[model samples]
Target: MSRISNGQLVIAFLACRLSSEMITIPGEMVSYGFDRFAVILFAKLIAALLYLPVIFITLKFKGDSVITAAFRRNRAFGITAGIIMSVLLSATAVQTVLSVQRYVTDTLLNNIVTISGIAVITASAVYGAVKGLSAVTRSSVFAAAVFGLLIFLIGVTMWDKVEPDYLYFSFINDRSHFLKTLISEISMNSEILIFAVITDELRSKPYKTVIYYLPILLILMEFLNMLYNLILGPYMTKVEYPLYIIASLSDIVLFQRLDGIDAIVWLMCGIIKAALLIYCIGRIYTVCSNKPHTTLAVAVSGFLIFMLCVILGSDAGVYERMTKIMNSGIHILLGGVVVPLVVLIAGRTKQRGRVKKNDENI
Candidate 1:
């Protein structure tokens, strides 16, 4: 099968990571501080630093996928890592489904509308995954182009309304709160895991992936934060969907509002994100079990994830899961730290054995 190019993966990855932030994160930023822009910038800096292990993992397993490398080096360790990854990817997929459903129902459309929307979204994702990573990557590139154009239009339309004075910095008064929020923001980034798994799929060097990704992600985030604070000012934190509200306020000549277009873009991006997770799980399963169940695995996983969305989309359940995921260090610990460490150790051990055998032959 053809592999996804680095450009395609990066575009898809960015769409997945940034789509949720367009609406949800801007509001949460307000609760942290009046200088939420500065706080977010700082938090992003922290996240960049924290992404080092992922970079290392990527570099270490550049020519092969993490799962392939693990299995080649050590089967026991491969099984352990595979199990950990399956659980983590499943959780991530479920959350993505639930969150997307919630966003559609609460912000974009009615409950009735959400049913059709859910069906279309889930079906599209499964189809994309079944088509393979290359197909998803191409679709993501197209989605990214459209999404970028829409974002550019919004920026141009809203440029005049932005106030430079709103970009003020203030000391973080609550140290504990700052720390907690910083950690939460960092942990919210599961895109790194996608990078780890897709190392072999990438045609480019692994280190280049992080180099290309983080700066763009950080800059986009900073731009959105600034835009939110500049236009919304004191009212930024008061709204539930600040980005949507911002888009609604944009009045172009022929187009009275861009909110509808923005809604579609968000949904498309969300599906790409969810489907990418499903694909990752399928890839890991296929490699670990030494079976070619890619299409079936993705279909079954997508179905289960959609069911999870229905079950977990309730207020209390979503709040519980979201809180646990955002606040917990499990993602960072397992995906970021432990998985990479295992790969590194296994790789080194295999290399050393080769060296010893060569020396004995000499």
Candidate 2:
């Protein structure tokens, strides 16, 4: 497959991150309100620092995922890397499915038999995964356009509702609260793992993925936070889905309200994210198994995610699984930071040994 364009990679990942944020509306982020501005700023900085290992590893092993590169050097190391990423990414896919289920149930379907919703989402995800990353990223352009129009509509109709008075300023007084919120914000960024694993090889200017992504995400999130604080003000706390409420406020024609369109756009983004995850899983499978059985891999990955969603159901069970994963921060740190760090260190140590041998021979 041809390399994924950097623009496509950036937009696709951005949509996934933004969609996840909109659906999640992290309690810490909502709770902190205006004060979250500082937390977000600091969190992005911390995230940038954490991303260095993966970024530099790409420079060393260009055109390969860390696992692929490691596997080339040491089969055992690559297998270990593959296993860790496979587990984490599979969990990530499940989390995406569960989130999509919750979003569609609470907003779009608002009915029973939520399993049907999971079926549709996972099924579409499989199709996208089968199409491969290039096709998936291309579809992201369409999803992004839909999201952009939604934002425009929201801005046009809801601007007057955004009372400057709704905004307020106060630092979080509790040190523990601030730290916890910071960690939560940091952990929510599973997109980094996607970039680390895939985009490094795809983007010609690999680091720009982070450069183009973080600020855009931070700005978009801050804008949404501002909307929550500005439009809903104190009343925002009462609603489970503030984005739904924001959409409901817009008086669009045909649909008569934007909430339905809001759901569709979010659903599209969710499917796109799930597809990306499944595709990555397939790629990892190819690396581990040493066969280009991408089609089989995608099928199996989709099946696995579908089974997980079915088994988990669509209630407190899914919620608890996702919550534990997010709260722990281990998945993000290990996959996004530690694994790449290992690759970087191993690569450098090997390079130095080569240099020593060359000098000694002289």
Candidate 3:
């Protein structure tokens, strides 16, 4: 396998990690009011800054996968952290697959398909995971390009619907509600830490260079949040698939309808995201297990994920309930425990030099 650059890692992280799920930001902000978008943005910025020190410490430890680093420092603590993260990643894959299925059913399919969409999504994810990191990263680049084009096309078509005044109004009636909603938005994007665990061989770049990229990411997120609010407003809460709403609103001279195309784009993104999660879990299993055949571990992990999707049921109601449960649970585990524990253990072990070497073999 060839080395992956930090730049490529960053791009792959952004592509697979970021999604149109920000479409939900407007609805999430409804109780907080429009100004809450700014507040949420600021909170995310602070969260990112807080995360930077941990990332720096992880790098200092020679880029150990968070689990391995924790394990090296304390076996018992490491195993607990690993179990929590593995379950969280698995739950996220199921939730994301179900969400995509729900979006397709409500916007494009009209409930015509009888077979399970979860199965199809799981199969695609397994295929990607089997191909390994190179395949996953390449697919991310291609998917990101396709999504970018779709976003540009939709923007051009909906240029006339833009309203500057949408920024002036507040969405929340009370200050406490606004703060709570802002925290929720931060929690939603906390998945970034999952990527941090796998990223061991980043391109050599100055700290300042990496820090400079944050503004660009935050600006794009803010713009997308504002765009959805301006176009959908209160009506946005009623629609489960706000990106599809944006797609439906587009009408160019040659291509009058693009909701089908949008659905295809979403399906591809969903597959990439699911595959990455599986890959993360597979990596964790490989590190923790003493098994001779790592491929068997991967297969077993895939099978468990498949069962999870099936048990959850591939419907809108099931999807919503499962999301509420998984999101809340995972956020607490990640923010409340895993990150802090990893940092604390790594500090005590002084195992920074051995982490990179151990990670390379695993």
Tens digits of per-residue lDDT for model 2, 1-362: 56877778889987787667756554534565677778778888998898788778777787567777778768888888988998888888888888888888888677857678888999999999898888898888998898888888888888878889878887678878788778877877777778766853484767877888888878987887887788888777677778788989887675578887778888888899999888888888877789874788899989988988888764686678667666567888999989988877887888899999999999
Local error of candidate 1 at 7, Å? 1.8
lDDT of 1 by residue, 1-362 (tens): 57666677778878887655643554554554355555567766766666676566566766676677787777777877877887787777766666676677766677555446556677888888888888887877888787787778888898898877776766778777666666666666778677667777777776676677777878877777777778887778788777778889998876788888777777888888877888888888888888975678888888887776566654566657665665465775687667877787778888899999999999
Clashes of 1: 0
**lDDT value, residue 264 of candidate 2:** 81
Query: Candidate 1: TM-score?
Result: 0.90
Give the poorly placed runs of model 3, Cα more than 4 Å off: 20-25, 74-77, 112-115, 201-213, 290-293, 314-319, 327-343, 346-362
Q: 34, model 2: CA deviation in Å?
A: 0.6
Say which candidate scores most in TM-score.
2
True-structure lDDT of candidate 3: 0.64
Instruction: Residues 5-101, candidate 3: write the lDDT tens digits.
Output: 5555555555543553522535655553366567657765765665564466556666665666666667776677668778777777776666666
- Sorted by TM-score (best first), the order is 2, 1, 3
Error of 3 at 361 (Å): 33
Which model is ahead, 2 or 3, in terms of TM-score?
Answer: 2
